[model samples]
Target chain A: MAVNELGDHLRQGHPLPCGRLVEDVFDDLDRGRIDDHGRTCVHCATARRSLTTLMEATRALVDDPAEPPPNLLDRIMQAVRAEGRRGEALPLVPIDDTGAAVVPDLGPVDISRQAVAAVVRYAADTVDGVRARSCRVTVDDADVGALRIEMTLSLRYGAGPANELVETVRARIGSALHGQVGVRAGAVDLEIVDVWPEEGP
Target chain B: MTTPDLDHIGGHPGDGPGDDRLVTQIRVAEVAAAAARSTPGVAHLQQGLWGLVQQLGAEAWTRVTGRPRPDTAGTEVAVRVDPVTGAVTVTVDVMLVVDGRRPAAVVAGDVQRRIGGAVYAAFGVAPGRVSVHITDVAVPG
Candidate 1:
């Protein structure tokens, strides 16, 4: 019997509910022999069919080496990017009882660190003459929920006084994190990594 | 092949829920995932590296074998079932890409309620902990 299933839970090292590694079951399949549990267990039965199909497909690819789709490279690169896991999970800041956030029992709401940085970068970029380069965020264990942000920025050489621009960038980031994302920025450090010419390059 | 329990839904290995509970949890995740995706301000369910890999592998298998392609891709939710007690806990720990334009709190709050409501509606059981993870914010080009 074949199953129209891919059992994502049954990965390289994942075990079947029948309490056997898929590989062990695969071994039993290769030998054309399965123990009593494997013979009767539905999960094992599904795994057996799926593995047989996979093995056949693998052998086909190895033998024929079919051409990859043109977009396969792009797809692979996208998968390689740590897009979804840009950073550690940040608990969505708790809101006061009177605040708008729906507190309690929603479980743990976490925002990706990389996503927060994007918001920070966008916030800082809004400041005139300043461009956000990179942002790194860390949470202090003692402080908890409070974040320390270190931002690298590029400034226009003639963009007014550097100090004022830096202050504006810092304020924007803090506001964005607290107001938009509901997380407080404990410390925001900005560095003028490079200064660009005012004229268009 | 039969329809995927969910294009994106899968179970945890160690907890090893029974077949019945496993199917129920997959259904809960499907409902939760759909609700979250349809919620305003959500761009798409975030696909982590591992999730992407699983999806690619699943698709590749279908393509190479000329098997029917799954109607959907991988769903990123974890469901646990207590073996002895048979208590089910749904963890909708989704990685999502939110529209950068919206307020994160409002968007996230909306996601939580929608998923919870969906699961509760379908299974008559509220997901114990719905982890709404905003993995990335998509900035308008």
Candidate 2:
């Protein structure tokens, strides 16, 4: 019964979904120490999936340390120097107003499908153990436009790390697209294109 | 010294209007190529010879060394030295003449060991630090 409560929290995306019972259950499963309850209980299945996804995302955050594009330094330095000269200290320069001047209030130009795709690509690359070989985003013009993104990943072979890579990529990409791009990516379909050696030959 | 104009001083006089980034890229690329060529037996190293050489080692000169004869069973080792890291890795591009029967993986491993050993012997550097990139495989007919 206590395990069921934990399962409910996990399914509902509650923080601290794993309780003492769930922790013990996973420990037992890991060591092949669980005898019967784990197999029969629905709680164990839900808990495992939730915990695994959470752990995978956390692992990706830890493993992803690849430096950003080197040219970023040049761009940043240029922007900083440009800002220093334009001492107005305003974030954006307001255009000079005249009697006939018309201003348009752009309420976040409906985040384009392309923007979401870019965020997805960035997030997918950041996921540890997953290398994004290619990505494509398609927008179906329905009554309401729907965005679908497909990503091809090169799984790193020769480790259990690759097994977790899929979930990490999905979670990170989905979150990044939603949060940064402000677009609801309906589905993030993934294809494991090729398994490259963990250490390249 | 007289104060020079900001625009002129900021601009590198060494860089002419005709001077393309390609020239700098090419020079860096050639340093990479030279590093690879200095190694034992690289059949065909890639265009970014520097990155490959830095990741690999200078084993392309194996044919010149006359170590296992080219006519007989032998492997071509390619080395790329990373100018930034000063690290070198090696990959053996197997040839059909050497019984293309050899596995690229096996040859790659052997090449890796030899390149690492040679780099260590030559530069007094450790091999494990080097990153080896296996860019190509040559299978015999």
Best by lDDT: 1
Give stretches of model 1 more than 4 Å off.
A1-12, A49-66, A83-87, A94-101, A140-144, A193-197, B1-29, B64-74, B80-83
Compared with the true structure, all predictions reach lDDT values of 0.68, 0.40
lDDT agreement of model 1 with the native: 0.68
lDDT of 1 by residue, A4-104 (tens): 12244345455554456768988888999978898777767767766787799878767866576788777655544434353466777434324465856
Q: Which candidate should be chosen as best, given DockQ against the real structure?
A: 1
Candidate 1, B1-141: lDDT as tens digits = 112232134433432323343344445656777888898888887555566666676667777766543322225555554534545556676667778656666678888888888877766667777777676777644
| lDDT (Cα, tens digit) per residue for candidate 2, span A1-201 | 323433553464311111225566556655766556555444455555544644554465456564544674664443333222222111111111221111221111122233334457778877666677787766634413335678898876764565577878888876664444333456778988888677866
Least well predicted 10-residue stretch by lDDT in candidate 1 chain A: A1-10
Cα-based TM-score, every candidate: 0.74, 0.26
Query: What is the iRMS for every candidate structure?
Result: 6.0, 29.7
After aligning candidate 2 to the native by TM-score, how far in Å is the CA of A84 from where it should be?
Answer: 30
lDDT of 2 by residue, B1-141 (tens): 122111221122444432221122223223333343334333443322222222222222222222221121122233333534534443332211111123222322333344445544433433332222323222222
